[model samples]
Target chain A: MTSFVGPELTNPRAERVKAVRALSGRSMRQRTGRYLVEGPQAVREVVRFASVHELYVTAAAADRYSDVISDAHERGLPVHLASDEVVAAMSPDAQGLVAVANVSSATLDDVLASRPTLVAILASVRDPGNAGAVIRAADAAGADAVVLTLESVDVHNPKTIRATAGSLFHLPVVTGIALDTVTDALRAAGLAVLAADGSGAHDLDDLLDVAGPAGAGDRSAAPDLAAPTAWVFGNEAWGLPAHELELADAVVRVPIRGQAESLNLATAAAVCLYASARAQR
Target chain B: MTSFVGPELTNPRAERVKAVRALSGRSMRQRTGRYLVEGPQAVREVVRFASVHELYVTAAAADRYSDVISDAHERGLPVHLASDEVVAAMSPDAQGLVAVANVSSATLDDVLASRPTLVAILASVRDPGNAGAVIRAADAAGADAVVLTLESVDVHNPKTIRATAGSLFHLPVVTGIALDTVTDALRAAGLAVLAADGSGAHDLDDLLDVAGPAGAGDRSAAPDLAAPTAWVFGNEAWGLPAHELELADAVVRVPIRGQAESLNLATAAAVCLYASARAQR
Candidate 1:
C-alpha cells in the first residue's frame, strides 16, 4: 500500500484525480497496472483483501463507511478524504468511495495447490455482469476458485467487480488461461471436468439422484459427484463450440422443464454450481 | 394485430417512428397501452404469443430473420419495412427489428385457475434486469407463472424484456399486485408460500435431503416439496423487512458454504426455483 497520505484533495482537476479517473479505461489500467474498485462495498473489499494503492473517500462517505476507512488506515494504506466533486470526478458510480487496486495476484497454480473440491470455469463469457454473477454464485456455492478463459471478459472490469457484490475479494479468481488448458489442468489435478452446455447427454436431475454415498446406488458409467469437480461455462451468446465442449470429460445441461430456449448464463451457472455443491456435500 | 401496412418508412423523424420510440418510456406505454419489444428473438415471440400492434424492420434484417417476418405476416400483424435510419430511430437496441405489443394479459387469477405447481413472486425489486432474469429463470424451472409486487420494476422496461431473453412471452407475468395479497392468494390456492431470506430457519439442503418420495426421510415439520409451492424473493439491496418476512408460512435459506454475504436476487431466485423444480420432479 502507498503511504502518500495528504490533506483533503479539494481540486477536482488535480493530476492525481485525472490519473485515478483514467484507470476506468482498459489501456490506462494496463499501463498503470491498476484497476478501479467502485462504491463502498467493492472499495471495502479491496481495502481489506487486495493491495490497494490508494483509497479516495468524501467526508460524508467517510462518516457513512467509517469502518472501511478505519480498516484501510489500520492496514497502512493511504486514505485520501477528497471533496465530493473530486471523488465523483474519479468515478461517477463510485458512491464517493473508490480504490485503485493492483492487477490480480491469483493464479491457477496457486488455486490448484489448495486442492479445490469445486471450481467454476468461464470460457469466453463476454458479459461483465454475467461473469461477476457467476463469481458471486460460485463463492456462495463454496467453490474454492474461479478461472476465466483467455477469451473471456476481463475480471478487472468495474462492472464485473460491482456485479460480484464484494465476493470478488472473497476467493481466488484465475484469469487469462485458454479454455482447453483450464480443462486439462483441472482434470489433471484429479478433479472431473464437466462443461455446462445445452447439448449434453446427462440430465442434472439424474446426476443429482445418484450423487453422494447413499445415492451412489447404481450407474457405473455416469460421472460421479463423489470426487472433486470443475465446471466450465460457455459464452453468453454462442455457447460452447464443439472443440471447447469436447475438452470436458462430460457435458451436462440444466434441464428446462418449460419452453425457455435456455436460461441466461449466470442463472444456469448458479443452478449447476449449487447442484455440484449439494452433490459433493 | 393491426393491419396498418404501408410503404417503407424512409424518414427517421416520421411521426410513426417517434410514436414507436416513445413507447420506451413509462408514461407513453401507459397512455397508449403498448410497450416496445426489441430484437428479432423477442419480436418473434411477441408475434407468436402476444397481441402485437405492429412490427417494424429493415430490409437486411427482414432477410436475416425471414422467419420472424413470415410468422408475423401469417399472424396478420402489421409489418412495416423501414429504412436503416428509421429503424435505428425507432430503437437503437432493436437491431433492425421492433414490435409494439399490448400490456400483459397475464393475471394472477388466470394463473391460479391453471393450478400452478410452482410460482415466483418478486417484491419491490427495482432493477429491471433482475426482474426479467427472475422471470426467465422461473420459466426455465417450469414455474407456472411469475408475479411482481406493485413496488417492483416495470416488466415492460426494454432492459427487463431483453434480460428475459424472450422468456417474457413463454409464461404469464402478473404485475401491480401487493405482496400480502400475492402471498394470501397463493396460500389459498393450496400452495405453500415460502420467503427466501438469509435469516431463514430452514436450510434448503436439509429440506432437499428429505424432499420427494424417494428421500422422504424424517423431518415432519420441514416444508415438503411434494405439494405445490410459491417462492417470494425480496429486493436486490434491502431484503425482506420483518413485516414482509412474516407473510410467508416458512422461510428457507440457500446454504452459503463460502464467505459470500448473500447471493444476488436473480441468482438466488434461480437456485430456489430450480431446487423446487428438481424436488417436484
Candidate 2:
C-alpha cells in the first residue's frame, strides 16, 4: 500500500472542501452524481461496496484508522488528509472520517433482473430516519433489495445514511420509481406483495402460522415463505391508503396484543421482515 | 362542566410558562415532581391516564382540539389558554398543546406485585429515542410493564416521551432500579428473564417454535409464552455486558439472516417483544 504522506488539508474554505460540503445538499449531489458518507462505519462500507471518488480523514482519525486509508489507496482511490476543521466543515456528525462516493445508478429493473427472493418497498415514506432504519432492517432480514418509491425520502440524505448504520452499502437500494411500477414488477417476478397496515384483514401471526416453522420438513404444506416475497411499507403518519393496499396481494397487520395503537414504520418493518426471514430460513 | 373563560397568558416568561419549561430539564423535573407532555396525542394521553396539573393550549389549538380541552375540564383539570410564543418556548414540538403532569412514582415492587405475565426490562439504554421506541414496542406487544435500570435513560426525557408516541401512558414504566434487583425480583416472581443479545446460546426462532402458536392447546407441552416472562434489552451501542447477559435464565439471539452485522436496539426489542406477544396471544 502506498503511504499517504500528503500534507493535511487545513483550510475549511478550500475549493475541494467547498465541493465536498456541497454534496450534503440534494441538488448538488444529483448534479455532481456524488454523495457524502460520514463516520467510520459508513465510510468503510462505502469504500468496500461503492466506488469511492475520494476519501477524507483528519490527521488524528487517519492515524486511528490507517487500515481504511491504506485500503482506499490500495483500491487506487485518492486518500486526502484533512484537518479537523475541514472534516467538521464537511459534516458535523462525521467522526473525523468522511468520503465522497459516486451514487449508484442502479434502477429497479437492474435490481429485479436478479430475481430477488425478498424485497422491501417503501411507498411514500417521508422521514429520512425511518427510511434508513427500514433499510437497515431489510438488510438484517437478508432481503434481496430495498425499493424507495418516488415520494419516499431521498436515499442519499445524510441522516438516512447514518440511520442505516452501514447497511446501505450491504444491499441494493433502488429509488425514484413509482409505487405502481414497483408492485407490478415484483408481482411479475412471482413475488407476493404484502402491504403492512393496521387496518389489514390478515394478522401477522396467522400469516406466520401458515408459513410453518423455519427449517421444518414438509415445508410444501406451508405458505412457502421460501418463495419470493415483497413487503410494502407505507408512510409514517397516514400509513397505506386504500388504493395502495389494494395493489398488494394481501394486507397484513402485526397483531397489537396491547393498547398501543400501532407500531412505527421502522419497528413494523423490522417485525415483518424478521418474520419473513425466520420463515424463509 | 365549569366554563374555562380564563384570560389567555401571552408572556413567554410567565411563571406558569417557566414552570412548564423547567419540566424539560431533569433536575427541574425532580425538584418540581412534574414533567411536560407535548403534542395533542401525548397531552390527551396524560389527561386520560395521569393526573394533569395544568393544560396549556393556544387559541388555534384550543379550537382545533376542543375535545381535549373539554375532556380536561370534564376531569376537573384546569385549562389555560396561552400564546403561541409561550407554547413554543415550552416546547417547539408541542403542536400548540402542552401539559404539566405529576410524575408517576411507581416502583419495581409495585409493578411486580401485579404478577406481570410479560414485561420489558431496559438495562443501561442511553439513547432517549431508543428507550422510547422500546417502550412503544413493549406496549404494542401487550407487555404488562417496563423496567429501566438506574443506568438507563431518564424515562421523562422530552425526546424519550415523544419517541414513545403516547405509549408511555399506556403502561406502567418503572425506572432507576438496579439491574441486579430487577433480574432477582423477576426470578423470584417466577418469571423467566431472557436477555436479548446478538451473542446468545438460543435462537429466537427455535424459542418461538418451542412456544408454539398463540391460543394453541397443550401449551404445557411447548414453551408457554402465556407464562410469566421478562425480556431484558441492553444499550444501543455496546449492548449488554457478559455479566448482565449471564444474569438471565437464558440468552436469546435474533437470528441475522442477512449480511447486516446486527439490528438496532429498538428493532431488536420490537422483534423479541412481538415474538412473545404472538406466542402469548
Candidate 3:
C-alpha cells in the first residue's frame, strides 16, 4: 500500500475552496478529474470500491468513525483532519466525511469482457436520482458491469453514489460510451442487447426467453446463469432515445398492465436485470 | 380558476437559507410540520400528488412556468412569486421551483376504502428513496393505497417525494400504523396477507397463479385487478422484523438467483406488485 499526503490549509476561504465548489459543477468535476462524495455511507463505499487519494474528516466525525478512518489508513490512504468549518466550506452536506479518489470511467470495450453480464446503460437518464438508482440496481442485480452514456448523470455524483448503496464498489461502471459502439461491442461478444421500452416490439419476457436458460428450451437442458446479456434503460424523463433504440438487439417492456404510466428508471432496471438473472439461471 | 396570493419575500437568503439548512435536521422538519421540495419536476409533482399548500417560484421561473402556476391554480392551490433570493433561501437547489406543503400523514383506515382494494404495507423501510419508490410502485401497480410503519422514512421528506415520481398525489399513503393492526385489518377484509421476504415460503409466481385471469387452476377463470389484497415489504436495512413476519399469512420471496445480496426495497416491491397485477390482469 502507498500513501501520499497533501499540505494542510488553515484558511476556510483558501484556494481549495474554489476547487471543492468546482466539484458541484459538471465541467469542473470533469476537468479536475475528481467528483466529491459526502456522508459516512458514501465515503465508506468510495473507500471500499475505489482507491482513495485523500481523506478528510472533522475531529468529532473522525472520532465517531474511527473504524472507517483506520480502514482507509490500512489501505494506506492519506487521512487528514479538517476543521468542521473547513469540511462545511467544502460541501453544504458533507456529513463530516469527504474523500478524493481517482475517477476511473469505463468504456464499451471494458464491459464486453465481463461474464454473466448484468449491465444497465442509461441512454439519457437525466435525473441524478434515476441514474443513481439504475446504477444501484445494476450493482444489486449482480451485473457484470454498468455503463452510462454521455447524456447520463455522472456516476461519481454524490446523489448517484448514494443511490448505488455501496454497490458502486462491487462492479465496474463505464460512462461516455457511444450507444452504437456499445451495441457493436455487445454483439461482437455474443451478448444479447435488450432495451427497455414502454412500446417495444416484444415483451421483456420474450427477450429473457431468448437470453434465459429455461426459455432456450431443449437447446440447453440447464439454464446457464452466466449467459452473456445486457439490459438497457432509457432516460428518466423520455426513456430510450429513438436512435439508441435501433442499437438494441431487442426492445422489451416490463409489461405495465395497469393504467400507470411507467416504472421509475431504477425500478424498471431492477426488474429487467433480475428477470435476466432469473432467465439465465 | 381560483388563484392564491400569499406572502412575498425578495431576499433569497430570507426564504431558503433557513428551510434548506433546517431540512438537514430531522428535529426541525418535525417541529415545522413542513418539508422542502426543489426543481420544476418535483414542484410539478407536488402540485399533482401532494397538496401544495404554498408554492414559491422566482419571478423568472414564474414567467417561464406560468402554465404550471395556472395548473396549480386550477387545482385551487396557492402559488406565490418571490425574489430569487427568497426561493433560494428556502431551497439552495431551488432550480426555478420550490414549495412548502402542509404535511398530511394518513392512517391505514383512510387508505383502505379505495375501490381497487389492493394495498401495500412497508414493515420497516428506512431509506426515504426505497420508501418513496415503493409508493410510486404501488401507484403504478394499481394498488389502491400504501401504508407504512412509523419506522419508515417520512413520506413528505423531499427525497421520498422525488422518489415517488409524482405518484404520491394519486395514491393514498398512510404511515405509522402498528404491524398487528395492519395485518388484522387486511385479514378482516378477506384479502390474503402476502409478505415479501427473502425466505418467503411461497414463490411470487405462486400467488400470481392464484390471482391470474387465466385462473390459477383452483378457481373459475376471472381476472380481478380489484381483488382485496395486501402486499407487504420489509425494512431495507434489516428487512421485516420477526414479529411482523409472524403477521403474514404467507411469506414470499422475489427469487433472486444472482450473486447480488438482495433486490433494493423499492425494486422488490415493484416486482411483487407487478406480479400481483399480472395475475389479476
Candidate 4:
C-alpha cells in the first residue's frame, strides 16, 4: 500500500475541497458521477462494498481510525489527511471522515436480474430520511434489493445516505425507474407486488397468517412467506395513489390497535419487512 | 363561541408573542408551567386532550382551519388571529398555527392509578426524536400510558412533541420519575416488566409465541397479552444497563432476521408494541 508523506490539506478553498463539497449538491453529483459518504460507519461500508475514488480524514481522525485508512490504501484507494476545517467545509456531518465514491448506478434489469425473493419498491417517497430508513429496514430484513422510483427522493443525497446507516452498501439499491416498470419487472420475476397503505383492506397480521407459518417448513396449506414478494410503499403524506395501488396484487395495512391514527413510513416499513423476514425464516 | 374581534396581532414584538416564544425553551416552560405545541395536528390534540392557555393562528390559517378554532372557542379557550410574520417568529414549524398549552404533568402514581393494561417505560432515552417516535408507537399499540424516567428526554420539548404526531395527547405520558420507582409500581400493578434490548436472551417472537395466540381466545395455558404488561426501553446509544435490565421480569430481543446489525430505537419499539397490540387484539 502506497502511503502519502505529504502535509495535511489545510486550505478549505483547495480544488480538492471544492470538488468534494460539490458532491453534496445534485447537479454536481450528477455531472461528476460521484457522491460523498460521510461519518466512519458509512465511509467504511463504501470502502468495503463500492469503489471509493478518494478518502479524506482529519489528522486526528486518521490516527483514531487507522484501520479504515489502511484498508482503503490496501485497496489502492488514496487517503488524504485534511484539516478539520476542510473536512467540515466538505460535509458538516462527516464527523471527521469522508469518502468520495463512484455513483454505483443500478437499473431495474440489473436488480431484477438477481432473482430477488423479496424487494422494496418506493413510489414517490419524497422524504430522504424516510427513504433511507426504509432502505436500512429492507437490508435488515434481508431483502434482495430496494427500488426507488424516479419520483422518489434521490438516494445519493447525504441525508438519505446517513439515514441508511451503511445499509446502502449491504444490498443493491436501484433508482430512477418508473413504478409501473418496477411492478412489471417484479411480476415478471414471479413476485407478488403488495402495496402497504393504512387504508388497505387486508391487515398485515392477517396477511402473515395467510402466508402460513413463520418458518418455511410448512408451505402446503397456505401461501408461504418464502414466496417471492415485493412490498411497495408510497409517499409519506399521501400514500400510494389509486393507480399505484391498482398496480399491486394486494394492499395491506399495519393495523392500528390503539389511539394512534397511523404509523410513520419508516416504522411501518420496518414492521412489514420484519414480518416477512420472520415468516421466511 | 366567542368571536375574536380584536385587531390581528401584527407586531412581532408584542408581549403575547414573546410569552409564547419563551415557552419553546425548557427553563421558560418550567417557570411558566406552559409549553408550545406547533402545527395543526399537535395543536388540535392539545386543544382536545390538554388545557390550552392561548391559541394563535395566522389570518389565513384561522380561515383554513376554522374547525379547530371554533372547537377551541367552544371549549372556552381564547383564539387569537395573528399575522404570518408573528406566527413565524413564534415557531417556524407552526405552519400558520400554534398553541400555548398548560404542561400536563403526570406522575407514576397517576399513570398506574388508572390500572394501565399496557405501559411503555423509557429509561434515560435522551434523543427527543426517538422518544417521541416511541411515544407514537406506544399510542399506536394502544398502550395506556408512557413513562419517561427523569434521565430521559423532556416530553415537553417541541421537537419531541412534533415527533409524536399528536399521540402525546392520546395517552397519558408520565415523566421525570426514577426508573426503580416505575418498575416497582408497574410490578405492584400486576404488570410484567419486559426490557427490550438487543443483547437479551429471549427472542421477541418466541416471547409472543409463549404469550399465546394473537387473539385473546386461549388464555389458560400461555401468558396472554391481555394480561397487564409494561415494556421498558433504554437509552439510544448504550441501551439498557445491566441493572436496568435486571429490574425487568424478562429481557427480550427482536431477532435480527438479516445482515443489518440492529434496528434503531424507534423502529424496535414499534415492532415490540405492535406485536403486543396484535396479540392483545
Every model's DockQ: 0.87, 0.78, 0.31, 0.68
The estimated TM-scores of all candidates read: 0.96, 0.94, 0.70, 0.93
For residue A15, model 4's alpha carbon misses the true position, in angstroms, by 1.2
| lDDT of each residue in B179-263, candidate 2, tens digit only | 9899999989988788999898778888787674463445334344555779999989999999999888878888887778889
lDDT of 4 by residue, A1-281 (tens): 33654678999999989989999999998999999999888898888888788888997888888888888988988888789999999998988999999988777787878888889999999998889889988987789899999988989999999888888888889999899998998988888788889878778887676664463444333334557889999998898989999998778888887778888888898888888877666
Clash pairs, model 4 backbone: none
Instruction: List fnat per candidate, in order.
Output: 0.87, 0.76, 0.38, 0.66
In order, the Cα lDDT scores of the candidates are 0.89, 0.87, 0.72, 0.85
Q: Which stretches of candidate 2 lie over 4 Å from their true place?
A: A212-226, B212-226
Q: Tell me how candidate 2 scores on lDDT.
A: 0.87
Between 2 and 4, whose TM-score is larger?
Answer: 2
TM-score rank order = 1, 2, 4, 3
RMSD of each: 2.6, 3.4, 7.1, 3.3
Tell me the tens digit of each residue's lDDT in model 1 across A191-228: 88888898989998898887876644344467776668
Which residue window of length 10 is worst by lDDT in model 4 chain B? B215-224
Docking class of 4: medium
**Top lDDT prediction, candidate number:** 1
| lDDT score at residue A90, model 1, on the 0-100 scale | 95
Q: In model 1, how large is the Cα lDDT of residue A114?
A: 99
Model 3 pairs whose backbones collide: B11-B85, B12-B85, B12-B86, B15-B89, B15-B90, B16-B89, B16-B90, B17-B89, B49-B169
Q: What is the lDDT of residue B2 in candidate 4?
A: 38
Error of 3 at B131 (Å): 4.5
Query: Which residue runs does candidate 4 get wrong by more than 4 Å?
Result: A5-7, A213-226, B213-227
> Which lDDT tens digits does candidate 3 get at residues A78-159?
8777778888888777887788777776656666655545566778677877776666667656678887777777777767
